[model samples]
Target: MTDIALVRVTFDTAAEADRIARHAIGERLAACVNIDRPCTSIFRWRDVVETAEEVTATFKTTITLASALAERIAALHRYDQPVIESWPVAVDTAVAQWIDDATHA
Candidate 1:
């Protein structure tokens, strides 16, 4: 098994999600990005409660690339404060190797 970084982000549109995914993969920041189903999010921003439909994205990359991946996502995100989070994850040997290959360039 290998340790990798699992990054999760939300976008207002599928286009936005796809754009981020493409950029991450193109830049070798992430090995793969899995676009998940749309979800409803409720939060408080600027003293106002807001609700919106959001698309979730899951990114796979080496732990070493997590910071850069998050930075890239923030740069490409449209939201004033995009939701970007990552944590270390353990994966099967083959999957880990694949991630390293995909992100290490």
Candidate 2:
């Protein structure tokens, strides 16, 4: 495994997803972000089960930047509890090099 992670975050809207993506890339916290369109989300909120449409943003970056990226996303997220998850990325030389180049640029 590489010292990198793939961060997954879901937002209430496309605008929200775009905002987080731009901020993360602009801050060098992420090398790139892929935004997925609105999709159905089923979860419990405030003791009530609910379903809502949401957009998902997946970010690629080093583990060292994960905390800062999460903090920034939380600060800008509209939801009281945003979906922010990170998973370790298995190393792939080409992809890892691209990530390093993008974040360092």
Candidate 3:
């Protein structure tokens, strides 16, 4: 695995997803944020099953910054408990280098 990380977040709307993506890139906290097509999410919340349309995004960044990026996303999200997950990932050497440069302040 490379030193790069992939942070995943789900937002209620497309607008919210775009906003966080732009913010994270502008802050140098992420190299790229891929806002995926809307998806249906099913899970249990407050002891009840719920289903909703959510915009998912995958943020590329150095593993060192993953935690900070997740925290920032959580703070800026509208959901009372936004879903944020992250983990280190494997990448080719060139891609890893690009991620490193892109996330640097």
Off by over 4 Å in 1: none
- Model 2 error, position 82 (Å): 0.9
Per-residue C-alpha lDDT of model 2 across residues 33-76, encoded as one tens digit per residue: 99998889999989999999888889999877777788888998
lDDT of each: 0.95, 0.86, 0.92
Q: Cα RMSDs of all predictions?
A: 0.7, 1.4, 1.0
- Mind sharing the TM-score for model 2? 0.91
Which residue pairs show backbone clashes in model 2?
A: none
**Quick one: ranking by TM-score, best first?**
1, 3, 2
Looking at model 1, the pairs that clash are: none
What 10-residue stretch in candidate 3 is worst by lDDT?
A: 1-10
TM-score of 3: 0.95
Question: The CA-based lDDT of model 2 is what?
Answer: 0.86
Clashes of 3: 0
lDDT of 1 by residue, 1-105 (tens): 779999999999999999999999999999999998899999999999999999999999999999999999999999999989999998999999999999875
Q: Lowest lDDT 10-mer window, candidate 1?
A: 96-105
Model 3 C-alpha lDDT per residue in residues 25-89, reported as the tens digit of each score: 99999999999999999999999999999999999999889999999999999999998999888
